[model samples]
Target chain A: MMRHWPIFFLTGLLSACGGGGGGGGGSSAPTQICTELNTPQSFTSVPLSAAPSSQPNSAPVTVEAYPTYGNGNFNIPYVTLQVCNGTHCVTVDHVIVDTGSYGLRVRADFPGISTLGLPSINNGSTAPIAECSQFLSGYAWGGVYSATVKIAGEATASPIPIQLTNDPNFPNPPASCTSSGSNIGGLNGLGGNGLLGIGVLIHDTGPYYACSTNGQNGPLNTPLNAILTNPIVSFASDNNGSILVMPSLANYPQGELTASGTLYFGINTQSNNTLNSTYSILPTPATGGNATFFSATLNGQAGPYPASFLDSGSNELFIPPLQPPGTYPLNSNGDYVPQSLQTVSGTATSLSVATDTAPLSFSLLDVTAGVNAGNTAFYDMGTTNSATAGSLDLGMPYFYGHSIVNGINGAQIQFNSTTYTGPFYAIH
Target chain B: MPYRYRWTVVLVGAIVTGTTHATLGGLERDVSHEGQPIAFAAATVHPLPAVPQGVHQQTILNLRSITLTEYSANGTVFAILWSGPTMPDYRSLLGTYFPSYQQVIQTQPLSPGHYRAPVAIHQPNLVLHASGHMGAYQGSMYDPSAVPTGLSITSLGIEP
Candidate 1:
C-alpha cells in the first residue's frame, strides 16, 4: 500500500497543475480539461435503455458526468421536475433524485420558480415557516412553501409542502440553523438545481422546530402538514414506493462518460414496477433515529453494522475498512488508494427477520486516473468510512445493473398475493 | 413553571457567566451550563457503567430529541457524542475546536465526484468522525490525551 502512495500523489499534482490555467479567462465555452490524460481503449459492453420509458409513472434519470455549470459529478442521478401554481408551471432540470432524504427542495433563486407565486406556509403566526435540513457534509436552509409537484406524467392532485431553499425573503437564518454546518443551498453547493427526496418516509422527520425572524425565540415545531413533505405521497396513484433501474457497468473499469436509467414510481402497483419474487426484502426501522437504515456486515469485519442503507444521493460506496487505518494508502482527500482492482463483499440483514439477508458486494479501484481523464461513472469506486465504522452507505454505484426498490413507510404493497407493509428495501 | 420564567433564568446565568455555552475539553460543570440554554428537556446525568471509576456521562436532549452525550472524568470532559434526526450545533459542542474542524472541512477535496461523504478529522490530539443523511445523523469527537486511562474511546459505543 505504501508503494502506491507516490503514484497517487503525483497524479493529484499533475491534475492540479492542469486545472490551474483556466482561472483568469473571461466568459468562454467550457474547456475540456482531461483531454491530455490517458484514456482507456477497451470499455464495458452492457445493454442499456437509450432513454427513459414513456410509462405514466416512469421518469428519465440522467447522469451528468461532467456538467458545464460546476465541477464534474459522478453517479449523481438527476430528473427534471415541474412545479405548478394552478395553471402556471415551471420546469426545472438537474433536480437530484435522492433516496437518502425526504421531500422536494428547490432553489428559490431559479428563474421561473421564483415567479410561480407559490403560497408560503405560516406557523399560525404571521411569520412564514423556515427549515434547516442537515446532511452528513452540509445542511440546506430555506422557507417551506406549498406547490404542486409533477414528474413524468404523475402530478399531485393538490398543493403539497416543499422547501424553497435560499429564499431571499428569509435572508437571516437563526444562529441555531446556520450552526448546524456549512450551507449547501445554492446550485453549485447542491451540485444540481434542487433535491427530490423520495426515501422510505412519507414526511421529512426531524426537528420541525425553527427560529423565526421576529426575534430570538425558543424553537417551535412546525405543523406536520406545513412541513416539507415527500411529493411521492401526494400523487393520487402509485403512492406506495419507487424503483431505480440502471444498466450494469461491471465491465467498465474506467467508467462511462454518461449513463441513463429510469425511475419508476410505485412499487408492485403496475406491471412495469412489480417486485420480483427472487429479490430480498430487508425491513428497516420505521421510527427513531435509525428509521431509514438497516443492518449489514461488510468484508467479514465485526458483526452487524446498524447504520447500513442504500442511498442514491451519495456518489460512492462508504463502507468500513477491511483493515484498520494506515493499512491502505489514503489520498489527501481521504479516499482509499488500492494498488490494483479489488472486490469486497457484505451481507445486508433485515432488521426484523434474522433469516432475511441479502448478499452485497462491489469493486474498488483507484479512481484518480479515470476521474482525471474526465470519465464520470465508475462502478468500482468507494472509500473507507472511518468516521462511523458501523455504517455501510451503498451509494449510486450499487444501483447499477439492479432494480433497487424503496417501499415507503406505512404504505401497503401487494406482491404475489402477499401484503408487505413497507418502510423496506428490495434489491433484484 | 412558565416558559418565560425558565428562559429568564437561563439568560441571567449566561450574562453573569460571560459565556454562552460549554464545549469539548471544558470542565464537568460546563456541561450543565451548555445544556441549560437550548435543551428541550432537562439534562440527565448518570454514571457510565463498565468503565473506569470516577467517569460519568451527561446526556442532553434537545428540541428534536437529538441526544448529545458528554463523557467526563477528573472533572474534565474527554469526549462527546451526538446522534438524532438532525445535526447538533457544533459551535456549541466542539467549542474552540470548531474553527479547526471547519478549516479541515472547507479544505477537504471533493474532486473526482461530488459525493455527500462524512466528515472525519484525525489530528494527533483530536479525532472526530460524523456520518449520516437527513432525518438521521450520528458522530463522536474525543481528545486522545484527555481520555482517561484504562478506557478506549472506540469501546464506548459512541455512534448509533
Candidate 2:
C-alpha cells in the first residue's frame, strides 16, 4: 500500500473586481476526505457504468459526484489508475486528478506496474537521479519506471515513466513538492496523493524536457519512463479523447451562488450526452502548449469563449491574461518574476472557436482567490526555467460551483445554459 | 455576430540559392498535434528539447493557414500551433478541432545566409462553400511567399 501524490484568476465587474488567487486556508486537522461542490438538482448520480458509444441526441447528462477518498480533505472524488498485467487489476485508490499538467503519473509500488529501466539521469557530467519539477506544481522526483495504466475502461500499455515522492532520496521533499513547506495558500491540499491531468496541451509543462533545457533526461522529458500516460489514450472505443460539460451559472442573490455541473468520459459517443449545438466551441493548443482563445485584441477582443474543457485534474479555473493592474509577482525556480498580463479583447461578447481556426486572445481567471491573496505560498505558478514560460494557471476556482463533464471521446467541454445561470460567487 | 475574417501572411524575401536560410512563416495552428506552427527564423544555434537541432533529416513541416469562414455562431480562432521558434503544443482534457492544416515542408536547421523574416497578415481570402455553410464570419490564410528556388510545393489546403 502506497500513498499517491499530486497537485486561477479573474476579473472585475468593471472595477468592483475582487482579489483573485488560488490558495486554501491554514491547514486544518487532516480531514477525512475531499470536499465536493454542492450537487445540482438537475444531476442524478448515475451508477459509474461503461461509457457507451452513441447517445440519443438529448439535453446534457447530469453526472453525480463520485465517492471522495483521503477522507474528504480536498481529496474527495479521486481518480484511480488501475495497473493491469493482463490477468489481474490493481486499482490505486490514492490517485489525484489534475488539469494543470498533462499525462498520467502512476507509482511503482502498484501491483502490476514496472519502471522503465532508463539510464541514470546525470546532468551531462554526474549520473544523478533525474527528477522533474513541472509548471506550477512540485518536483516529481524518482527513479524511472513504466507500466500499463487503466482508467475506467481505457488504458495505455507499458508507458515510459518515473515514480518518486515515495522515493527515499526525495525524503524531506521541498515544500515545492510537499504540502508542509513550498505549497502556499493551502493549494497543497489540491496536491492530492497522485494527479491525473486533463489540460488542453499535448506535452505537460510546455515540452521543456531535461534533454531540451539541461541535456539531462528528466521526468517532463521522459514522463513515459515515470508512468505518465494520457488516460484518454487508454480508453476502449472512443479513446481519442473526452470532454467536460458545465452549466452556465448566473450570480445569485448573495452574489455568485454555488452551482454544480457534470463530467463525462467520451465525446458524442456517450449515451447520456449530446454535443450541444447551442454553446460556443473554442480550440485549445495541441498538447502542453498554452490554451489560447480565438482573438488577438485585448480587453475582450480574443474570444470564442464560454469555451468548455473537461478537466477534472485541475483545482481552479484557468482563464487568459487580464489587463493592467492585473499583473502579479510570482516565484520561479526561487527567484520572483513578474507575470505578464494580457487582456481578453474582441468585438463580440460571446464567442466560440471551432476545430480549425486562427489564433486569438486567451485570458485566465486567477484561481487562488478565496485561499487568500496576501499569502505568498498560495500559488506555485510553474517553473521559471520552463520552455513555455507563463504565470497563468487554471485551478479549482475554474471548477467551483460549475457543472463539469470529463472522460469523453471527442475532446470538448460544454456548458448547459439551463442548469447554471450565474452571477459568479467567491470560492472561499 | 459580426463576421470578421482573419489570415496569416509571412513577410516575403528574396529566396537565395546555394545559401540555406531558415525561413519562418507566421504562427499557424498545427491541428495534428494540438500545437502551433512556431517558426524559428534562427535555430541550429542552440539545442532545445522536443526541438532537436542539427538538421538530422530534412524534416517535413506542414505549412498551414487558418480561415475563419463563419462567425455567425460566435466562433473565433483560438491558437496558432507552430514549433521551433514559438510555443510548444499541448494536450487537452478533451480533444478539439484545428483551424490550421498540416503542410509537409522539408525543413532543416539553418546553415549560412540561413535567415528568414517573419510573416504577418491581417486578413486574406477564405472562401466558404455553397451549401448551407453560413458566410457570416471573416476568413484568412498563411502561405510562405519567399520559398527558395527549386523547392516544390507538395500540398496546399485551407483549414477551418
Candidate 3:
C-alpha cells in the first residue's frame, strides 16, 4: 500500500498540471495537500525508564504523536516489553498498550524476536499451529509460540503462549485467514512494534481459536494453556486486571507531541491501583451476546445502545452520527469535519445495572486542521460508528483524563465496600 | 422423520460450496450452496421469523463462533448480517462484489492521526458497515436496488 503513494502523487501532479495549463488567463488557487508532517529522521524515541521498578505492578506508558518506529501514530499508548526464553532475551520498544483485545503479539520481523528462537507450540503435531488474530479492518496471521513476557518488573510466572505474527515458518497463510482483511502483521501497517492486549477477557477464543495446521484450515486441538494466553493473567499477583492512565490532552487543541502516563497491572490489589468510591463500576456479562459491552446513549439520539464498550485499540471515538450522514463534511480519511468545534455527549450505563452510568462527552474537530497543524494527539477527533446501531465504541480519547479499569473474567474485585466479579469496567 | 432426515442430508451437501459462491445480489439458492468446512464442523441452521411481507430470513450458526444471517426476497438474497469473534469469509460472502469492496477499502486515504476507524461503504447500489476488536465483531451489508419496495434494511433488526 505504501508503494502506491508515489504513483498517486504523480497522477495528482499530472492532473493538476493539465488543469492549469489547459485554461488560458484563468487562475485557480493552489490545492493544499495534507501529507504526513513528521519525517523518519524527525522521529524520536520516548526515553525508557532507568530501571524496572521494584513495585512489580506498574509500568510507564508513553504516547507520541510521532514515534521513532512504525508509522506516526496518535493517542496510542505504548510500553516497552521484554520477551525471554531461558537465557535468550530480547527487549522490544513501542509495543501498543491495548485494552481492547487479549494476549500479546509481536512482529516476527521485529529486531531480535526471530533470533530469540521462542519455542513453537505444535500441539503434538509436526505441523506448527498457526492463528489468525482478526481485527476490524486487518488481521495478524502467524504461529503460536511460548515465551516469558515481562512488562516493567512484572513477568509471567511461566512461558505463556503468544503469537509471533508473520512468522517466517508460516509464510503463506491459508486463504481463510488472508481473505478476512488486510495483513497488519508488519511495523508499517500495525503502526507499532507489536501489540500488548490486556483487555477484560482472560482468554482470546472464538474465531481466534480456529488454528490452522501447516497452512491448512483445521480445528485447534490445543489446550487452553497452550493457546495465545494473556500474560497479565499469568502473573503470580496483580493478575486480575489493568488500569490505563493517560494525561489530559485538553489544553492541546492542535494536539501534543508526547504524553506519558502509567499502566498499573492490578485493580484494588495494591494501594497505587485501588478503585476508590469516586469511580463508577459498570458490570458486563461474563457470557452471552456482546459479553464485555455495556449500554450507552448519545444525546439527541436514541435512548441506549446495548453493546457499547471502552476500547483503547480504536484511535477515535466511534458513535452514531449526530446528524444525518451528509450533515457534516468529511475529510479524505472519512473523519467528521465540522465547520466549527462540535461537542457530542452521552451516557454509558452498566449492562447489568442500569443505574450505574458514566457521563461521556467529546469534541469533534476539523481533521484536516489537525493534520495540517502537524500534531499527533488531538482531543477532538472522532468518526462515525457504522458497524452496530446498538453500539458505540468510546476509544482512546475517552481515557485521556480518566483512570479506566478493566477487570478480567472471573477475577474478584473489591471496590468501595462492594465485592464485584470480573468482566467489568470502572471509570474514575 | 424420514422427510426431516433427508432434508438434513440435502442441506449438508448443498452447504459444502456455500462459502465461495453465496453473495449479495445472487439468488437465494446461492446461500444454501455456501458453507465453510471449519465453520460447518459444528453447524446449526435456524429460520428467523419473517418481518415484512416478502422477505425470508435465516441464521446459520458456525461452531467456530460466527453467525451469518441471510435475507432474501423473491428468491434473491439482498442482504447479509454477521456477528462473531472474527470477520466472516467476505470473499465468499460478497462473491463478485468482494473485489470492489476490497478496492474501496485499500484505496481509502490514511490520515496519520486516525487509522483504526470502522469501515463504512455507501455506494449507489451497495452499502456495507463493519467494525469490531478481537473478541467481538459485527457488520451488515445489503443491496439497495434488490431490496423489496417500501422495506428498510434496518427494519430487519440486524444487530450483532
- Write down the TM-score for model 2: 0.39
Off by over 4 Å in 3: A1-55, A66-72, A206-223, A324-333, B1-21, B26-50, B109-115, B158-160
**The 10-residue segment with the lowest total lDDT in model 3 chain B:** B37-46
Q: Report the poorest 10 consecutive residues by lDDT, candidate 1 chain A.
A: A34-43
lDDT of 1 by residue, A1-428 (tens): 00121232223211101112111111233321211111111122221111223349999998865345225577888999899998898999989889988899998888898788888876555545666666765666667788999998888879998887776655444444455455677776677889999987766744333333343322233455566667887787777778999889887877787789999997766778877787888877765556677788766467567778898988888766666444455676667777677776788988756666888878777877777777767777788675344788888888988889888876676554666677789988
lDDT tens string, model 2, A95-212? Answer: 5454434555544334434332323333224323323323221234333334455665445644434333233222222221221112211112233345555443323321112212
**lDDT value, residue A356 of candidate 3:** 76
Descending-lDDT candidate ranking: 1, 3, 2
- Summarize candidate 1's per-residue lDDT along B109-141 as a digit string, tens digits: 443234268767777667888877776677888
lDDT of each residue in A320-415, candidate 3, tens digit only: 656654555566656778867777778888877777788877787775555565566667777777634466788887788888998877667666
Instruction: Give me the TM-scores of chain B across the candidates.
Output: 0.72, 0.16, 0.73
Can you give the lDDT of residue A412 in candidate 3? 79
Q: How does each model score on lDDT? A: 0.67, 0.27, 0.65
User: Worst lDDT window (10 residues) for model 2 chain B?
Assistant: B129-138
lDDT score, residue A324, model 1? 48
